[model samples]
Target: MIDYTKWDEYYDGGFADEEPINNFNEEYDERSELEKLEYGGQKTNVTAKQIMQETGTTAISEKFLYRNGVVIILLDYSKGIFDKWKNGRILHCLGDRTYTTQQNTNGLSIIDRTLFNADSIDKIIVRAFWKDETKKYRLVNGLLVLSKEKPYTIEENGKYRWVFPLSLMSKYNFQMPEKYSYFLDIKSVKEAALINADKEDGVRLTTLNKLARFSSSKNDIHYKRTPQKKIKYTSVQEKIERSSKIAENALILADFKCEINNDHFTFIRKNQNVPYTEAHHLVPLAYSDLFNYSLDVEENIISLCSTCHNQIHYGKDSESLIKKLYANRKELLKEAGIVLSEQELLEMYNNS
Candidate 1:
């Protein structure tokens, strides 16, 4: 029997275990033609049609598809590998099947020609799928620059792969289905990439102010109340992207007034003509990896005047302000899957 728990072993061993294959094949063989085309093992072109339909892209190769000057590569997820040197996640697509001891030269040539020589292709969209603990497939989509480096070659059979190093461009990593579905809209992926690029290039405060108007209202905000699954740490700057929309909502819910003191005065902005309180993460986003849940949610964001915001970051006696903020939002934070004591929160600031 294949031990699903030991994915590392199963993957490294070339999936030689017979029981799971027999089981999977048996279940797969009974499905309708449409279902078979829609979902299957890595060898199957399962999501190709879905991608083409969603993006109006044409397949330049079996794995490389082209649409409007962009290349979208569909990859089957291997184990998560974090490259400390790159400070990002490295995801790969298994090259081709191996027969006996020899690698397929034809397969290697095709991949090389398709990807390596594509000078015109500046951006590549990567859509990867991995099965979760429940055996349901989850999807992670990101936009990346085409790497100039050659594909990594492995001595292990069936392990020759093309790897893409990815930087975190969005607040959320994987998109979970509302129902048991594997489809991710292509449009949403592109939009998110543009937003992240803008955030990286534009002024931080200006970007937030522009997006604040589009943020969801207090009544419309909802929390999953469950711990968010962590992606392989893929940040280029070691900083996770914060959701401007969530921060904006927090500011809106606070009536654009300082949570530290409602009487605190700040000049109104010309853009929105509201009080210019800054949205500060009370627990700080730098300590996100320590928690099971996300720190980017509305409940974790506090509206503070410029002075108070600066105080939390620079003042010697900021602990009292943190204590008051924590006390006010502890229950709400708990509901949003963030649980930390006042001392721990204070320590986060101190350490930073």
Candidate 2:
């Protein structure tokens, strides 16, 4: 069993490092590589019931094992599951068995009750894994989001299943440890998921203030460069998640002063002893899909004092403040693959 307390050790960087075993003896084994990885070399297929037993969970669901505050789901990459809904969002479907009637209420009810009740599971951590070309089950990606929508039944080919739509709050990559087991320890897995989520600024901003200081000292803010685009997910409300790191970097680059006017003084933060400034996306993340590139870059972020921040958001003269910020960042935005005419930009804010 892997010691998930030392979860940092389990991450093997990414799947790119693993090489496919093309010369492996396939004639001896009729099972595909994916099946082998999923079953951990077992001749017979492993059932979710078996996995639940191994994990020591009493959860009724065969698809997901819910314990504590986390939701662990096993995804099959070969099937190309996770249906893509309109606006580029992905939908994860519950098992094929339908459970609408009271007598049939089993696993789905447990999931619905746990997810909707606020006091129950506040954190929904998705530990996503996939079978790689190396015939190994690699922990590829993860997602952290709140469940706002209820599961509804969908029918196809005379068969019915529950479909749950999740908005992408945060998406992250995972790395496996050198020594690992196919059967995950629920306690350890939960700890590891939380740790990984924190690293990506996906779960919570617990380390945002600490990271801001470190980034300010180590990173050069003058050199304008675009960061790797984050994977976009569809949500019912069409909201986009922003990176806390990018916003922190923007604040650091601005020397923790208001961009509207540096002379506008604010109280120093007790923890960091720096002027407390908030980060704002000049081009809102909601309209990210309209552009070809990502809108969550540092150049698009602006630092502002709390008073000025509120003024820009709530004050009547927001247009003046917007104009000033746009003029200053027009060139920088162009460099970062975000090009918008001043008039076009104003219309966005005005419509909002």
Candidate 3:
């Protein structure tokens, strides 16, 4: 077995001297980050499971999952690699009922045992998380199967496509957890090799390299014009302006509402399709904290009618009226699919 702990030394100057990235930006923090990665680190041999757990995602040169969604690994668990005691290196047939530990002499399959050793048989479980546009994550609703015939491929824009390694794409047979939030562990394994809850984060970070990205670049990428680098340059100013526009769009996406009661309605008789309320982003582009454009996810925006918008500036009678409006329209609110909790409404009010 490879000693993964030795990886710390190896990762000192890691990512096989770092992954290649396409773009080049000297003043960008991304460049600094790339330079700092495993800046002076060493590496250790780690298991595929360990690396996968650490980074929350991994792509292997070999295919592991098929296009139709199947899984192929139970990991080294069954091989007794995760057992607590080294001597009990026995194999367990599928559906075997009992097993014996090193402390006792008799051999049982999947029954009772006093001492749990390193050679104990166990199963491996897996789950996944994804990084969405805003650098926040929503658990994946479905899963894919991984098999020898159906290995997966890492595609551009960071998508995982399922395919076979050698020839044809194969389907795997395994049930994924209903929810994406989960952990994989060695089941029925010995306690010594078992990781405790506290150190799990460490294990994950050490093995997976959670924050590292492979930085790739094309060859013959020589710079022609020698422009001296300066941080004060206004080149990113244009980029910042564009970023604001995207942020505004994100606000509109999040705060979409049909009506805020007829009282606040615009009553455009010609166009009844228009919503009575105006949806907006909470963090106005005026705020400098947001840069590189902001994601138009739910957390960044909200919807309100003209009355509420005006009342936001002069918040008093409108606050009570808004509360009553929301309370009274609880059912109508459901029609628009916006039934915010009292606490949430209050938070929006406060933030606004």
Candidate 4:
């Protein structure tokens, strides 16, 4: 077992000079030589269940589902997580059954005990299973954030079963896929790359897209650029623009809704035979030069109706509007490795 307490040390400079303790057999391992990954951090083959069990969290019912390495915890108690949802945040506990320190053998809450000993279990998966139906979700920062004005719910047991808000899911594209394994595991950037490029894993597109973006953002890659014999400086500035493919995909994913206000396009374009909402890049394309990663991906783009769209770029209170939109997209942008703070983004616009 890995001593996760020292994860930060290993994650930094400590493991750079060391070799992996275990080796995969050549014939049995199907991965090519290049695909064989070397980690500059501690690794263990331990499963998520084993990790959870070690922390004194066990399966209360078979409803606890594990798929592809992701564990889905179902909160069925009367005063479950639903009670903790407040002020746009859910106070998520580590274990299903809440107990006092005296009741628990470890003399600490499940989260306290686990986090005291280990780093953390990066993502938390939750879902609903009732009346022969299931609904799924992965927490946004392991907590649900409600919209300020809209109190949305699909009441179950006279309360909301869908603890995570639908607007959030739509904004972040967290809709549960029709067919998904209880477990989700993507170990390396290569795996993430493969998943992102794959087209046939039913409901894989959105889920894998998110996973891939998160994975790619965290991993290091060797960037190669072709050599240019000479460089020229031009007085004319190139137009900072989003890729047509990315814009088109963003519009399609949004289903023509104005993400900023949750309003629909008032009119349909005759030629396209579809509602028309312009794609607005959350991190504006004009600032493209400041970022290393592509700023033209779907995650960075939002669909808006003509009114909201025009107001965003021109209204006197556009800064406030931009800040509001930034709040909606901050998490998504962070997942994709864009880190421009609200103030920094505002400054760019103000200076311009």
TM-scores, all candidates, are 0.40, 0.38, 0.22, 0.34
Question: 3 or 4, which is superior by lDDT?
Answer: 4
Write the residue-wise lDDT of candidate 1 on 45-111 in tens digits: 2355655655577776544566654455544234432111131223344443323334334544443
Off by over 4 Å in 1: 1-206, 214-216, 222-242
lDDT per residue (tens digit) for residues 237-262 in model 2: 22223366667777888888899999
Error of 3 at 295 (Å): 3.5
- Tell me the TM-score of model 2: 0.38
Arrange candidates by lDDT, descending. Answer: 2, 1, 4, 3
Top TM-score hit: 1
Model 2, stretches more than 4 Å misplaced? 1-215, 218-223, 226-228, 232-242
User: So what's the TM-score on candidate 3?
Assistant: 0.22
Arranged by TM-score, best first: 1, 2, 4, 3
> Residues 5-24, candidate 4, lDDT per residue (tens digit)?
33233322234444432332
Better of 1 and 3 by TM-score: 1
Question: Which ten residues in a row are the worst by lDDT in model 4?
Answer: 164-173
Candidate 4, residue 113: CA error in Å? 34
Residue 334, candidate 3: Cα error in Å is 24
lDDT values, one for every candidate: 0.52, 0.52, 0.29, 0.41
Better of 1 and 2 by TM-score: 1
lDDT (Cα, tens digit) per residue for candidate 3, span 1-352:
3232222232222224333322322323332332221121111123444444543444422212111121222223233332111111111111112222222334532111111121111222222222212222222222211112222233324432222222111112122222222221112233333234214323322322222221222231221222122123266444434333333342234233423344445432123333434433332222212123322222333455656656754667656655554565444433332323444444444443
